[model samples]
Target: MNRELVLAPPLAPPRWYRLRRQLRDAVLALPRYAALLLFGAFTVFPFWWATAAALSSDGAGIWIFPAAFLPNDPGLRWFGRVFYEMPFWRYFGNSLLISTATTLLVLLLTIPCAYALSRMAFRGRNALFVLLLVTLMVPAEVAIVPNFITCAQLGLLDSYVAVVLPNVAGAFGVFLMRQAFQDTPAEVLDAARVDGAGEFGVMCRVAVPMARPMIATLAVFTFVAAWNDYLWPAVVLKERLKMPLAVGIFNDLTGPFAVSTNLVMAAIVLSVIPVVGAFALTQRFFLSGGGLVRR
Candidate 1:
């Protein structure tokens, strides 16, 4: 007996069914996308408003509710005047120096301290960390009087060192670094020691290199804090030329911007550019898995 074999029609999903599945997935993802968009807009709107206000001629007809997104009459007069009307370049330089130096110092002090706290076995380690954590809870204003007195006695008042000295030993950087360094594997560090790498060598060659993401994160925060510092520096740095951008901008904006809204907005816009650029550059580190080596 011969058997006849026949193939049934393929059980493929219809085109409309596939389309429906895709639509469902997109609908499920829509809320997440919406949340991200809203957050982005919330974060970016202030910057956009400042930029738009700066470009608008005298910010005329733009300060009202439902503010104009685009300027009706844009001009660079305020931007040009920002430099000409005051000693802004000197202030900018002072801010650059202070912020950059503060960032470097924060890294130098924080990384080593964090490494020791995370890797070394020592007495009072937990207690010391707890003490540091307690310091973070203290309001910065409480330290202002002591810092001022110390600077005055040291004759560091009205100097760059005065401006930078107080901010160097930030607890936040150390805390962040400690968290980052703890994630590093001890076995890898032990292997490095077997290869004749001492503590310093291991730190420089291996741990430091691998922890770039957190380092960058701390650096950006330290830099921004330093750059935007007005109260402490203003209290310490009395010299007219020694003022940072924040102090200088606030000082200058008082009189001229009373007559023109554009000047005030322009100053805000300029003040933010350096910080925004720093953030944009360093954001890649946090995005790249917070300094963890994938391998």
Candidate 2:
């Protein structure tokens, strides 16, 4: 008996075929690239316009045809005026203190709560989680009056504590962390326990390390919220010295610099810098989701 042998082609495809496939993929991806660029431009244009307005000599260029997007005579005078003419630094400091405090407090409260809810079996755990979800549905406006009264009774008005207290913890942070913890591999947790690690040790060493990305994501959200919060801060703080940038800008900048569009834009730019930087630092965690695990 005899058998015929068949020849096989090389592992790599022909050059022409590879080029054709690459060309096809590029052509197919054109619409997606176009959409991304369009949205990116749409998102970036406002910040560009604001920056141009802040830099413009008279800020009249912002209203002009093509100059609205491009400043006619860019200068740093408005930015200098932002500091000289108002308590911009004070507002910035207040916001920073409140936002930092709020983020830390929210993390401290949510981490243990989420760990317990995700790993521990307890009575009324489901009911407790449901109650938390219900809080998310309730309008924050509904709590404003009661919160104000509580703050007043505690004599915390016009202080950093007043502003930070209302925002220190939130149901959203707990829910996000709970979801992340629940996604962690149970085997890893069990291994930690088998090594003589208690529940607290397992949570601290195994669970938290796995959920670092979610924790970063929640921290960024909480910081951004606390930084940009206007209503609660405005309601609780009466003194200009304690007002965060969001509320201070509205109450103070609206009075004199309202007409000075350049100064107003400069102040806005300053307020936005911290938020953008914070997000930029933690952006990878958001993109990586729960996969940014520690080794």
Candidate 3:
């Protein structure tokens, strides 16, 4: 039949309805927000304690329960003591060089290897990848004895080379990069191949660009690992000047005559700055890169 058409403006929800919806959402989100806040506070407590201790005029009040959190008399004296009492600049330089070298070497080695694993068809490729995965299950500490002996045999002990060589090729990096490479679009890869691009060219021009976030994440991980490394460097590096910041602080500052909690805490604080700064700089890529593969 015959029908009449009528048009009407959309009506907004009542204010009470909107307020109720918002209140419901807030109530629903309360537990998640609470959990996050609790974990954040837990994570921050140690850094706060260390900073507080470093800023304290003396170490006596640092051990007390409530007093521990607040500096007795905040000042820069402990930080000053850290510089005067230790070869901090030398240690800083050594850590920086080693960490940078490690990051570069890891990227150089893992990218090609991961690309091959992800894109190239080869016999026993699955088996090889499985073996790499298996290596991830092994703790790094398990290899220290063999690494030390090999370093000694090669006469590379007490050097940055020895410190950096062991960590250059990591299964975790290869795995991470391989996963990222695997997510690259096959159509884009074929397009590259059709454009007179070989495997190396496709990887360099196409895959690498898309995987930049993952690469940045890997670089940050490698740098932080190399920077914070203590055990291996302590074992291999004998010379006072050769030590990285972590080893140098522990070895030089904890001696009987030099022992002071305030100075040690100050040194620890100084050592942590670069790591915090690096992560802060790359945090966006790091957090987003894990599951994201750019098209």
RMSD of each: 3.6, 2.5, 2.1
lDDT of 3 by residue, 27-60 (tens): 9999989999999999999889999999999788
Better of 1 and 2 by TM-score: 2
Q: What's the best-to-worst order under lDDT?
A: 3, 2, 1
User: By TM-score, highest first, what's the ranking?
Assistant: 3, 2, 1
State residue 189's C-alpha deviation in candidate 1, in Å. Answer: 0.9
Candidate 1: list runs displaced more than 4 Å: 1-12, 288-295
Error of 1 at 89 (Å): 1.4
- Report lDDT per candidate: 0.86, 0.88, 0.91
Top candidate (TM-score) = 3
Candidate 2: which pairs clash?
A: none
Q: How close is candidate 2 to the true structure, as a TM-score?
A: 0.92
**Residue-level error in angstroms, candidate 1, position 62:** 2.4
Alpha-carbon TM-score of each model against the true structure: 0.90, 0.92, 0.95
lDDT of 2 by residue, 18-84 (tens): 9999999999999989999999999998788889898888776678866598876888999999889
Q: Is candidate 1 or candidate 3 better by TM-score?
A: 3
Tens-digit per-residue lDDT, 36-125, candidate 1? 999999999888887888888756766774666676588988888888888878989999999999999889899999999988889999
- Candidate 2 segments exceeding 4 Å error: 1-12, 288-295
